[model samples]
Target: MRASRPVELVCPAGSLPALRAAVDEGADAVYLGFRDATNARNFPGLNFDRDEAAEGIAYARERGSRVFVALNTFPQPGGWRRWTETLALAADLGVDAVIAADAGLLRHAARHHPDLILHLSVQGSATNRAALTLYHEQFGIRRAVLPRVLSLTQVERLIDNVPVELEVFGFGSLCVMVEGRCVLSSFITGRSPNSCGVCSPAEAVRWEETPAGRQVRLGGVLTDCYRPGEPAGYPTLCKGRFRVNDITYYAIEEPTSLNVLDILPALVRAGVAAVKVEGRQRSPAYVREVTRVLRAALDACQADPDGYRPDPEWTGALDRLSEGQTHTLGALHRPWQ
Candidate 1:
């Protein structure tokens, strides 16, 4: 692995309280979105409004935490105006950076706000060094949020070759599909993940009691039918059980969280610039707990790379707070098995 300094902890803040909690618990930076289609996490009753966003930015800045606004989703044909306007507003708010995926919007930001720092979102699927370098060369993107599909070795290679900074998903819910390449949600519903800013819209989920036990469905497709004693997980299409070759299996990914607390040192040595925590829909309490634990772990690693070992208690704490029935390193170590 290509070793580097300790990586920055860039966490998610879906709401004002979560923003405050993240900063207080020791997040170096917080990434959030406006409550609109311009952001990928465009769920109802989530995300910040203009006033709330400004307040959250100020709150984070006062506590020495940087704020990055996500303008990651591709714009709809006639709805390009909304994304453009949101970018302008984010720049006006003095956010430390803006996470963007669309090429056109990146061009607009590069032209209009030359000094505004741009971080390429993983939604752009910049997996390789060539693609990452191209974005940096063309749009002056300072950092790239790499797709989750790359292994640690691959990330080390990309980091070695790419000129821009690299951010990887350190801990989060693993999306089975390649980042920026998933169309499963859109195939079932009219909404497109890239353009509509949602994968499986919450409104499309359905659950009911069945003769076997409980059946969970998404967009009228049976996702998983659980026995009476089995733990029920959220019905996202990727994590749902499906059949292939006459054998029922999890076609995409099993319902699992990505908890990489133990692998902090390995990731730090892999030339990663930032470590992202992916839970915009989680509670502020979850933000606080996870941030506090990871912050300490990173601090320990920075203090003594050779002597560092993540606290077993903190790892347990994160696992307890995680959703689904299990957690794993996902594709970071190897291909999802």
Candidate 2:
């Protein structure tokens, strides 16, 4: 079936160049954050500062693309002012919208920046119609990005039931933790994922050679070990291979990326308002290529809904960019679901 509307292709803009890359490659909108703890993806040298954000937003708007500033992290009691300031900055800079999760912050945005478009971040953890409805009714959120844990059927049902627009992840690295409820990173690192954006903060990671293999540890806890010639993934507690019950394996979740190109038609039919490419910590080249591929695929799907099939070259390109050099449908089409 043809999409009810042309789904917005939202991409990441970690830097100015990444923003330019996505806009040039046909992203309908590009989301970013400030270079502070007020937003996620707060790794050193990753996000934008004030001047940089203004420039990036101008660059995107001039090219007919929207800019969204992510103020998605929850604020601790004393530090809440920073979050409020970030929201104000986004509005002052003429940002197209701001993606926020915290109910208090959302209320603040609605009360103070009432004209600004509000999008409930995936961190808001609204997995049901009631939650989506509540956010929409209370704060007037224009859209909500769903967490990746939901199945296809659930997404379709939510779309049918909810009044707000829905955006789902169509590409990028998969997260093992429940969205908005991450504590695994906090327990080991002495930093909450809310405050520290890095899954395994680089400074705390140590890779060493062991008699068994190459061992990668996060904050001194051995997370994964690999034999010679084995490609090690980015160190994270959830994707780690650990010795559980005498068998060393990836007991929690294996490393992989999410690619939904094959199911584009289904998403369109389900009335998805947007499909996002999730990588703000990735490189400029990564953003350019992934955005290019998805733009082409979305266009092709729109052109030939009944006959849409992913091109082989497009599949290969996305696979090369995927985590661990492979991709899956993720939870969208999971048989177990």
Best lDDT goes to which candidate?
Answer: 2
Q: List residue ranges in candidate 1 displaced over 4 A.
A: 1-6, 335-337
**Model 1, global lDDT:** 0.86
* Cα lDDT of model 2 by residue, 120-179, tens digit: 998888889898999999999989999888898888888888989999999998875558
Clashes in model 1: which pairs? none
TM-scores of the candidates are 0.96, 0.97
Writing each residue's lDDT as its tens digit, candidate 1 over 1-337 gives 1325458999989999999999999999999999888988888888998999999988998999999999999996798888899999999999999999999999999999998999999999988877887898899998998887877777777877888889888777887667889888888876766878888888888989979779987889888899988888877788888899998988877788887777777778777889999988888998898899889988898778788987778878887876673678878778564
Clashing pairs in 2: none
lDDT of 1 at 218: 83
How good is model 1 by TM-score? 0.96
Question: What lDDT is obtained when candidate 2 is compared to the true structure?
Answer: 0.89
